[model samples]
Target: MNGKGTKARWWARTATTFVCVGAAVAATAPSAFAGATGCNDRTCIAVAGSGLRVESVTASTTWNGDFNGHLHIYGGGIDRNSATGFWGYHQKFTVPVGRDLPNGSVLCAEGWEHTGGGLQLRGRACAEVHF
Candidate 1:
């Protein structure tokens, strides 16, 4: 295999291991936040908004297995989702640092499901935040 392919496989393996460890930790841990939820689904988790100033946003989807959602930021600003035809998908976003959002700048994920779509959301997005 090529060097890129080998590196990708190694990364995937490491990521999978991290996910498993995270799951185990979550299963035994107790959360302090009342409104927080965690998953790889419709509502993933509650990101702490305390002292957080959002600076930017970016997202990506690795495979076409499940999700095809758009992120609605700050209420009205729309950021469409990305998909790689037949195999992969990806997306990126940018947000201002001081923009206010629900529950500390909520990023709403919305999508549709069909014959090729299931209910899983394997992809995620992240933003730079300053406290």
Candidate 2:
């Protein structure tokens, strides 16, 4: 109807289109460390070595006497799957990695537990450290 009305409508449509496009891009974007290492959560830990070796891997969950924990720590084409006899608040497993791993290698671990009901996942995370 008027110049002011037309400009306002155009701006609103442009903003809406930008927001939708941004959401789509974020949904399709890859993670910064895909399948690699991020130990942001307090429940999981990935213990890496100075070089290409990882000394140990640890995970934790709520203390449940009837639960047992399982950890799968892997990187650089190396994987270590381990389990615990009983469920404690913290569970650590040893994964002796040699010095043949490459730099910038990512180590990730998935932690789960065998509970009274069924198998439950604790958390999955990765961590990176340099010498």
Best of the candidates, TM-score: 2
Encode model 1's per-residue lDDT on 90-119: one tens digit a residue: 333323434433333345433333235444
TM-score of each: 0.29, 0.50
Candidate 1 lDDT score relative to the true structure: 0.40
Q: What's model 1's TM-score? A: 0.29
Residue-by-residue lDDT tens digits, candidate 2, 1-131: 89999999999999999999999999886533212234433345546444445554454443342246676777667677776666455555657654545556666766667678877766667766443
lDDT for each of the candidates?
A: 0.40, 0.59
Worst 10 residues of 2 by lDDT: 33-42
Candidate 1: the clashing residue pairs are 57-93, 101-105
Please give me the total number of clashing residue pairs in predicted model 1: 2
